[model samples]
Target: MLDQAQMRYFEGNYQACFELCLKGLEVVDENLKEKFVELAALSALKLEIPQALEFCAQSYHWHKNSYFWTLNLAKALIIQQNYAEAIKLLNAFMGVENPLKLEYLHALLRAYKGQNTYNEVENIYAILLKNNPNDLQLWLEFGEYFEFIPKKALGIYQDCYFFINQKLQALEKNTPKIEVLQTFAQDSLTARFNMQKTQKTLIENPEILNLKNFVNTILTQRIAESYLRIFESPLQEAQKAAQILYSVQDKNLQNAEFWFIFAHALEYIKDYAQAEQAYRYIFAIPNAPKNIANTAAFHLAYLLMRQERFKEGLEFYENRLAFAKNTTFSQEYYQIAKNAFLQDSKVFTNKEIFVYCEQGFGDTLMFSRVFEVLCKIAKKVLFAPQSALYPLFSAKLSKENCFANLEILDRIPQDFDFALPLTSLPLFLGLDTLEKIVTLKTPIISPTNKRKSRKIKRIGFFWHTDFALKENNTRNFSLEFFLNFLLELENVKLVSLQVGDFVLPECVENAGVGFKDWLDTYKVMENLDGVVGIDSSPAHLALICGIPTLVILQPRFDWRFGLYEAPKAKFYGENAHLFVSNPNDFSTKNTIIEKLKSIF
Candidate 1:
């Protein structure tokens, strides 16, 4: 039990360690009581429990001969704001003529600070820091001590910069840097803030005489970072930091850590051009850690890709390597593609090429038009598309359509020269520019489901995708959001192309329950005047069939939809309309409703 408690304490599980130590005290021997009391007190202090003072007092009382126990009790007294008792105990302990770590003297400084006694504080701190020049703990505590007093901390940071630089270098080169960064990335927040005046105040201060040189340069960066971490709330603090960084041009741009913070600030404010430039610069920095550089490289393309500049950004999309490890590559297929992925522009010319669909059915449908171009480039094309899409493609590309070389297959052949994803088609097809790629081919225009007689135009829409396809339901929504806009229109028949178990209003005719696969949905889509949906296969199929489809998306939508800036989809062409849904931006919803009214 004592061993378990000790292990928990060392592992930094303070609550668990404190609880285990309590249980241990009941069973431990007299000699072992000291360890129990020590772990319990230290863990309690970390947990910020009131019992920390009680346990610390007991530990100090029972272990009167120990140097560290005296310090622990003093720490508890300082935390409890018993400034006189803490000062008396610390001074007596210091008078014992025993050598101590710089961190131990910092406890005395803490006691002095509690009483607002600054007379000896600066002199003691400077002497200790000068003597213990290499003490990391002293430097960290010193930084923490004067957090709000940015000027004092800035002076110390400048004085002991060699030691600070060494510690930074060690942390930067740590083997676990990537894992650490990955962990920090799991939670993120956003808020609005402005820190321009802080810079103005720091510059204009008359008392900041000698500090002016550093303040205008490194000290400017230091002051901005100083009080940020004393939290007001996560979002507000995050904004304060980004806003603070925005006005901080004196920052060392060469530092990986500085670049990381600066780049994120640029992104938070939607200054994507500068953010992309910063990320690219970080990626090219030779001195930056590989993990940091790779992280910058990973997000470098998103700035452009998210803005619909895939032509310039596709080759730089390394996010697959950094975040979506499983989706990025499977060990089985990575083996083949790693060496032979689209070997040459004419690699498919008079040769057998294997094309597989790996992304969602919507992505497949969006990129499927390139397959016909693939057929034209190759003597024989071995296509392994989604099974649900097989019947539609096989029928569409039959001998009658003159696609005799294209073969839709259930199993990929072993003899194909090279393998590639359907999404990667443009890279090898020599459609090197975004313009050529978007216009690769028009969507499959089918003649079958066209309604000859049109009176009240029938419109089909679905607002959901397979739950597994979208994380956090970003691509799914309650059909009720659109019901107001959709149903309000005059001379329109609402048809639900939605599948699965869904509740629909009585006014909506449920056409989705009849669909077994995308082929069924495609057939149904042809009979409608148009379709509306989130980024799902049904909408992609509707758009591909050259039906006027309104793809309702969130502001930060799929790479295919581009952004709301231009509000045009060059690749999906004029038959397709993109509407990025933001609850605050009702103009888009109004536009979509007006577009629906015109169709009738």
Candidate 2:
């Protein structure tokens, strides 16, 4: 009965085998109790039965000396997330040289990882590699441990590919022996029989096929992802990733993950057309991973928007809501949830809406106009503005008296029908056309005081602005370079718009001292002739207030800026002077310098 049950399991009929094993365990002889229990436990695990862990525990309890059952019990504990017990059990077997040493190390790895002791996980990985240096699977496991920290993982994945390829080459070299037998088949019947048998044997060897799959599918994914992460060499690394991904069999056509990465690589390499096609392919797959598909949609939309295809881009942008969370913009950075946010095209007539602030101070200020638009549609609008700008928003919204339904809150409210990030308002309103979307105009914040007539012109200037983003450093130029250029101008008094512990020269008037809020900055900005700064909130404020604004944008500016060389952004319409700083083109900064001279 045990042999029959084992045969059923081997034949892939786990349900039948599970039933047989469960029935056999009740009537099995004591002399054969371990075999029946072990078989039942293995079958239960395959079928994912609740009793799998119980059976394993029972087997191990009966025969504590059995290494096989001990390993099984440890595995059960790990699966149930009882990491301490699993770690204790695995740790006991570590010193001895046993047949299941690798399995034991991996169990320890899982337990350590569950406990978040990454140092212990790394130690286990080091030991695994030291003992099994030539194993590609071990290298793959090591690479996955540093998934977010790609810089550390890239080398490990590359090494895995090297070893996997070597194994593949060895397999290819041995193939000629079978061919030799086939070549001499006409000379003898025995040669023909030998050739046929050898072919059958080779076909049955799943190890070689599995090794090739490691190179083609999983390894390709790891290596390409790592290549895409290298920021310094975006174009170069993206090209390499595209090359490696392209080399995969079947062109990775049916694989959503493959197509997603391929699309990103195409975008990086500036092949917009193929990138668009690759992104579209993932959307066609009905069963594609929700996160991967949504990400593909985002990249596709961004790619189109970069090329001035606004309506098409906006359509794709809406697809991202399928995976968006019902949370704050700041929480959206770290939180991932399924399509819980509003995406079903539900109308909000007579419904209370919860609008949360997203991104940064500049982004919040930029998107705050949407609240007024939202107020008209929803019966009651509960707006949670950024904490820093809460006082100013409360004050300003009160003065406008635009909507009796709108209420600004310093913190997130408990009751709301639906929620959205302020930036996502355009998509919710079905404003697919760029013309319908709101732009920064003086209406949002009219000048508090008209510009005073003076012999000397006052211009707001800032050389440093930090958003805590990865690409923020590239947006900043040398302060000395800015100071030298500014001090050279005649009849121009520079007012430092610098905030947060910035030291300014005596020649430049300090304007950001003891600032209560953005309203204080707005009061000072309203009196200035013009404002010039790197991509920052003050620049947004200046544009919205109808002040002449000169913004020095880095080459990798925000998506809102549109084309690289455009004189003005479509959204920052009022008094916008945007110049992209391209290091390759020396004239980029020189042009800004010329604009500064004229503005000052």
**The candidate that achieves the highest TM-score relative to the unseen native structure:** 2
> What are the clash counts of all predictions, listed in order?
0, 0
Question: Candidate 1, after superposition: displacement of residue 146 in Å?
Answer: 30
What residue runs in model 2 are displaced by over 4 Å at the alpha carbon? Answer: 1-130, 141-153, 175-201, 249-251, 307-312, 319-362, 371-382, 398-407, 411-421, 428-430, 438-443, 448-539, 547-556, 563-568, 579-592, 598-600
Model 1, span 275-384: residue lDDT tens: 77778778666689877787676566656776766666666653444443454334455446544544544545777777887666777787776766777767787887
Residue 10 Cα positional deviation in candidate 1, in Å, after optimal superposition: 10
Cα deviation of 490, candidate 1, in Å: 2.0
Q: What is the lDDT of every predicted structure here?
A: 0.66, 0.72
TM-scores for every candidate against the unseen true structure: 0.55, 0.61
For residues 1-600, what per-residue lDDT tens digits would candidate 2 score against the true structure?
Answer: 888998998998988887887778678688767777787788776676667788899889888977787888888887788889988987787778778888888888888999989789878988888888767767877998876567778987877778778877787677522322223445577556664432232242356777777678788988998877654545677789889888993745678998887887777677878989889899898799988988888878887877768778876775655654455543442222114434345556667887776457787777666666677678898887777777766766544555667887888788877677776676666666666655422225467554556667788887666663445224665466566556766777898877767567888888887577887787788779888787778787777677888887655456677643343466666577776654334434455668776654
| Residue pairs that clash (backbone atoms under 3 angstroms), model 2 | none
C-alpha lDDT (0 to 100) for residue 207 of candidate 1: 26
Q: Which stretches of candidate 1 lie over 4 Å from their true place?
A: 1-270, 285-299, 305-310, 318-345, 395-402, 442-447, 466-477, 584-590
